[model samples]
Target chain A: MNNKVALVAWREYVVRVRRRTFIVATLLTPIGIGLLALMAGYFSTKGAVSSKDILFVDESTIFRSADPTSETHVFRFSDKNISEERDNYLENHDVLVHIPPFENLGDKKHQVQYFSEEKLSVMTINKLERAIAKAFKNHKIKSSDIDMEMYNSFDTKVVFEDGEVLEKIAAGEEDASKSGKLNLIIGTILGATMGFLMYMVIFIYGGMVMRSVMEEKINRIVEVMISSVKPFQLMLGKILGVGAVGITQLAIWLILIPVILWIVQSTVGLNDASQAEQMAEIAQNMNGQTSLEGFDIGQIISEFQSLNWGLIIPLFVLFFFGGYFIYSSMFAAIGSAIGDDMGEGQQLMIPIVIPVVIAFVMLQGVLSNPNGSMAIFGSLFPLFSPIIMPARLAFDPPMWQIALSVVILILSCIFFVWFSGKIYRVGILLYGKKVSFKELGKWLFYKA
Target chain B: MSVLQISDVVKQYGDHRAVDGMSFNVPKGSIFGLLGPNGAGKTSLIRIITRITGADSGDILLDGTPIQKTRVRDIGYMPEERGLYKKMKVGEQLMYLAQLKELSASEAKKVINHWMDKFDISDWWNKKIEELSKGMQQKIQFIATVMHEPSLIILDEPFTGLDPINTNLIKEEIFRMNDEGTSIIFSTHRMEQVEEICKDIVLINQGKKMLEGKVSEVKQKFKENIYELIYLEGELKNDSTYTIVQNDGQKASLKIKDGLRANTVLQSLIQQGIQIRKFEEQLPSLNDIFISLIENKTV
Candidate 1:
């Protein structure tokens, strides 16, 4: 790079990095996110442990008896009527559930009333409804003279096995099926996280570049700068400098967020050992009630270890730079064209913002089917590839597709930088005139 | 030898010809004035010379070599709209500009320190530009312009927002730098400063040169053979030898008749029994010449 360009870049970096806002935002954001995650975890565990106790007043003698104990709700049968229990239920039980006798077993509109001192939580209401329905079904089955063992055996679940997993199983790999499911879960999460992260960083740092350019122009320092070095050089330098700031912030977050979360988790673990034990017992009890039967943390860790991070990490960085360079150059152009009116600047931003938003919205489809035609097309196109490709990286998409996307993105980056430089050179000196897209097009043809 | 030369320069913006076939040269170590009206292509021509923008068709030679990217280090420019990063410290801003002008970091520091001390603004090194008053900022701007010590310096309306004290301070600095063999191009519509400082001038109007010469020669060229007379005794009146343009008791302004020398008019005035206190030929001021030239173009 030219020495003058380096000088400009260094100045930009130093000025921004020294700002109090930068320092505060860089160090505090991860800490804030960590605290929020911890609060969410604590609340969920607390909710699971606090089970509601209910008095079940069954006026229908035909109803079969149930176990009456569940992970989140405990039921106590009562021979007394609902009205008799409702007035005094608050003294002992959290709720009084009244199931009245009905003539029709096939009726779907039967109502069950729950009387409580406070509004019942949605989770508690759902559990009560499920228990009543199960008892009703059991009573109908018994009246029909059906064997209960044969009826219970009719409930079945279907599990999907990928071809690769089947092949591994046939080859006598013990944990192939578990690893396949784990890969799907982890890949979806990693892909979504990486995709959204790229989207956010591009906007944040790209806007920074634009604002920096506009500042120079508004300050009227642009003329002084261009007189010393080429306008193209100045623009390139600003983009690089602001990008470095973004990367530095990202790197800090990458290191700080996990560390902060771990510290908070360990401290909470040490401080609330008895609460932790209660949480483990609740989890164990809930495991039999909920459908999440095969959830194993150890298996998840192994699956994550088996990922192609060597390819994914490096490609992520490449796409990051490629995306940043392409978008920031366009941002620099728009910044230069804007005089003092910020509204006009926003008008120019629509064209650039539309593609980014489309890429983000398309991330869902890509994560759902990483090898779908829409995914292939989105990931191959340079404008959307930076966001979409990183999302599909975990799926182990064909090597040719990834390579082609990378090549296209790199070429597009070069073209955009050159194209924007043309506009930037002319626009930075323009003032007090309302610039339109038509005017910008004309500027592209202007002599340097 | 000329330090800078522009030949047949033409710059057009769409239908408007900002600079049309304009040419001039700045002699070595000379304080050259580039005088023009608001839209007379003075800035366009200056930009070409400084390599901020290229001419459509022209040659800009620095020390007889065609100007190139590398030659940017040989010239320093302060535009009509003075600007520096308001958030940047005075010392750091100057250092940045100096390095852009190709000064090494150490050389830039040394030169910046020397200038700060000379301007008695060493205390302002750490002060942000926004913290200073406008005049103080202008002072710092001037220091930034010349701190790199370019061979040629171009200042466009360099004194616009300055108070008289700071203006004189900058004016003195311009002269001192010229004395040290740095050529200067001073572009402005203000002509009195040109008269006071510039040795040579090029007056342009409508993207074309209207006048060019030494300040004294141009003033002499525009003189109309008029004279101002202050006499102690007689009341002056219009006559065949001269026409009285303005008259008062014991004072008159006369336009001498064609084919008559200035001495003949003085002889005629002395023969009228008037005791003369003062008599001198009147030469037009640059302000008058500038106004006349620009107004003539409009007519």
Candidate 2:
């Protein structure tokens, strides 16, 4: 039996892997995911490029007294009419830029008229506005006795451990990029993405398994197949075949997404700085206020560092396979009986598919109320729990609740397998006959 | 030793009796045709013997022991409705079926390849079954059935969809398998094929055996001492003493009534200045007897 079952499994895997559909799915997944990653990199993320630059043209009656660079500039002219200098400046610069003349003193709504050969970044926009505002301020400051650079106010970030202030890093120095919040956001996103992947694979790919079984059974090919293997063995072989195909697709996606995303990021970074500057300039341009006073790094670290991965991954994998098999096996059996052809197979599919669809529907609710009665009770149902329970558990769910759900899911899967096997054995052989629930019941209970 | 012994088996589908106490024995090394029409309990009997479906009563013996579910592995059954997984390759499907019948991998491949060559379908090995023509599909289905070399082979209308050329190809293989000591029970509505190949035969109509015996003996049991005669203008020189059955001058056929010896009639014609261009005995064909028996039962 062991050898035979292995042969059946090996045969199923090899044949399906050689199929055109499987080959297309395997190759297309990586390319699709890579494209998705590239697209995502283009929008808003850490490594994406910015596209705009603005040239400061602060011509005001107010006297200017400040330093300048490409990032921060003040329009300083030797003559009162420096319009000739602007022509020379425009001729020398190669960058596509926005040129806003700072003239209107106290406009309430639209302050300054700006012109751009292209779009501008928030950082450059803010710097240009500050330079012009400073020219107006300089005349007032010159009238008084204050020096401008002496009044440069710099903002400071505060750190706290639990409730007390931390004067220095553990390494006895502070790092330039304070990335604790960024790390927290990325980590949370990764955890949620992983959980969603499992839920999606089970709910979607399990349907694919059912459709494949329906294809074979509708054509009456499963009759020849069942004669050789026990109905249980055939069901196992099919589920495993789908698993192998799915993992192959996932493997391709895993390899290509990072590689394509890297390329897209590098490509976009080469030419555009406006978009990239906008993201970083959010710290000051919008609100000009960011305070991390008395912020505890310990809690952020503890939220992630103290996470128990020993509990989640193994349980998730177990429930995923168990749930996938149970749903797909039921589909195989029901698909076989609906009709002796593909058209009729779909009629039966709509009803059988309701469970997986309902499971997906409850996923949002699971996320919203991980411990709500609907979420908790739904996590105990075999079909829905595979998707919902693992997800709720991703965010530090109670160990006992997860354990109980897994136990219930595992037990129900065993019963479903037995029930489906009986249906598959009898259903695969019946041909040219209309099948009903009543008729299927007869086949299931009728003793031979 | 007999390869299969089906004794007093009964199968019912609801109130309808599919096999009414049918019993038979298949001696080893013979092509036994279980003859019947579309719904005449032939499939029901085949299912019981193959252990695909069980009998409501009575028992089946395999080599003198009562057959069990596990014993089904020893019986190779090719059903009337042929099936092959369309997206699956011919070689792969056959190999899987071979393993299902308990053949070791190497043995299964060797046998599958051998049969593939024998059927002239080695080129079809890697091709998907759906790509093959119906005749080619039937050949692949046949290979799947017989690849394991089970001792008992049961085929139900195995030649249903094949063209004449492919039909003859499978026909010879069936004979070859039987000659090599495989006990085969061939079921078909094509009585000509059954008549040409089967030695011992069983005829069932309306869920009951109408007749069962060696082909010659069963033909004799349905004898009417009748002969259909065909004669040209130069041949029919006879007349007044013999009653003319149905005679048109260009074409004539007659059934020899009882007490009429064929040779005596021929001599009488020879003496009567008549010519006997064609002389033949009208033996009952399996088709003739099948139609007559079925027609009788319904009436």
Candidate 3:
């Protein structure tokens, strides 16, 4: 059985690697991911595409700032009837931002209205909202002889007091870096989870293996297979063989990524490892910002480093393999049950995948607080742990938590294997019958 | 030594009895035919023996120890339905099947190449199963099955979709395997093929065994009490002693009563002025036997 399993795994690995589909997917991944990132980064970096005009109507001169630019235009009215000004602006500008006369008699509120041919971007509306608040601040500062410039910049701070100043202490660094980190984390999570996603890939692809098996069983090829190898050995070999194929393709990508990275760094000259390493080391050695002009290698390394990867890599690998085997076994079982074709197996498969699907949606929340109740509870549950634990590890989950999740995932794999095997034994040979969930459940629990 | 023994096997699908107390033995070194009509429990018995599904209440013995999940490798099964990975290449597909059956990569390649060569399809090594014609796919599938060298082989309608040349190709291989000491159980609706190749057979209909024995024994046993006589001029009549079941101009078939014989039928026909050109007992073919069995059950 061991030898057969080893053989099966090896064959699965080899043939899958050689498969044109596997080759295509693996090759397309990095390029596809890179292009997607570039497209998204370019669009957001260009500020979400807004060139529309924002007309500002002011009753008081203080409300009108010094000659608002083309993007932002301000109109002043001597008379309370601003209809004439509105008509003039409407004949030319893109949108109307009406500012009603301020009544400071008792209330600080102004009855403002905004009208446009089309709805404005959320960012523009948000900017208008802030501008209104700042206008109110200007009215409050009216006769105090206060420093408006100092106050305009008061929304920021730079404190340097005692301890080794963290780079985040640079004040606006946190928010500015926050968005970048969020997007980066999202991208990394996607890339890192590719291996984990392979669990899904294996089940999908491995289900294909099982479907193929059942087809033969339906047709009687499995009868031929059983003649030489034990059913257990055959099942294991198939799983391992296909699993190997998935791993090999990934392994090739693993080897290829570094090589590709090296080649890019060499070609571009910006990613020179030695230079990167030196800059990284120099940034690490720097105390505070002496000039604050050079790279905050900490930020670069923070993305690549500053990580609790001690927990990250191991859990990722564990969740990936464990999740893969668990799902693939079901797929195998389902494949055999379907015994007909890919379209049929998809029936049982979708229901089985509900737990994983729910976990993925909760991942955003899970990443926010690894040790939180949701993450911990979700992690303890076998299905979600495969997706949740690795994501949570980016924030450094406790050792016991990580260990527990791993243990659960491992045990779940074992249980699922035995369960799926029972189904597989019955399913592969069943032909001419469309299997149902109820029938499958019965097979899962039936005594040998 | 019997490679497979199915004792008092009973199988059901819902309320339908697919195999009702079917009992048969596939002795070592023989090609045993499991002959039956379309829904005649042949597949049910095969599935039971393969342990694909268990018999509702019965025992299937492989080499005298009850067949279990671990005993699957001892039996090779070629189902009537052809199941191959449509998108997979011939060699890779075979290699995948081989690996699953516990052959090393090198061994898988050797066996696959040998079979591919033997089937004269070595040039199709890189072709996908879908790319091949159904017959060619059959060859590939056949290789995938027998490559593992199982002791007892069960083939349900192995000749399906094969042209005469390919059919001969498969037939020759089945005989060669039998000669080399491989016990085989084959099920098909084609009666002539059974007569041509099978040494012993179990005939089933409506999930029950109608007749089981050597091909010659079944023919000889049912041959009695019926005579086919061709006469130039005669009145073939239905009498109390003999019933004329079929008559067409110059030829007639008579079903003789218990006390009567073929000679008696001939004498009665002669006395009735029937000049017989030929007089012989009609031997029932497997096809006639199968249809009669089904008709009897319906009655």
- Candidate 3 CA-lDDT value: 0.69
Model 1 DockQ class: medium
Q: In candidate 1 chain A, where is summed lDDT lowest over 10 consecutive residues?
A: A288-297
Model 3 segments more than 4 A misplaced: A36-242, A245-295, A299-306, A339-347, B1-3, B11-17, B54-58, B62-74, B95-118, B147-151, B205-207, B232-249, B261-276
The parts of candidate 1 lying over 4 Å away from their true place are A42-84, A97-113, A128-159, A164-179, A268-294
- Model 3 interface CAPRI class: acceptable
lDDT of 3 by residue, A1-448 (tens): 6876676566556656766877788888766655554444344333353456556666554456433333333333333346765566667767766676665634666667777887876555765666676766676665456688876776765533323223454554343333333333443454346425744664566565665466556555565555445565667777777766666666777777666655544554442333433333344557422222233556655555545457567667777778777777876777777765657767777866777678777776665555689989977788777777666666545778878888888899999888888888767656678788888877665434
Give the fraction of reference interface contacts each candidate recovers: 0.63, 0.43, 0.41
What lDDT score is found at residue A79 in candidate 2? 41
Please identify which of the two predictions, 1 or 2, would achieve the higher lDDT against the true structure: 1
Task: Please give the lDDT score at residue B48 for candidate 1.
Answer: 73
Looking at model 2 chain B, which ten-residue stretch has the lowest summed lDDT? B233-242
After best superposition, candidate 2 residue B199: deviation in angstroms?
1.7
Q: What are the DockQ scores of the candidates, in order?
A: 0.64, 0.41, 0.28
Model 1, A227-299: lDDT tens digits are 8888889999998888888888899999999999888888876235434444444556576222223656577
Number of the top candidate by DockQ? 1
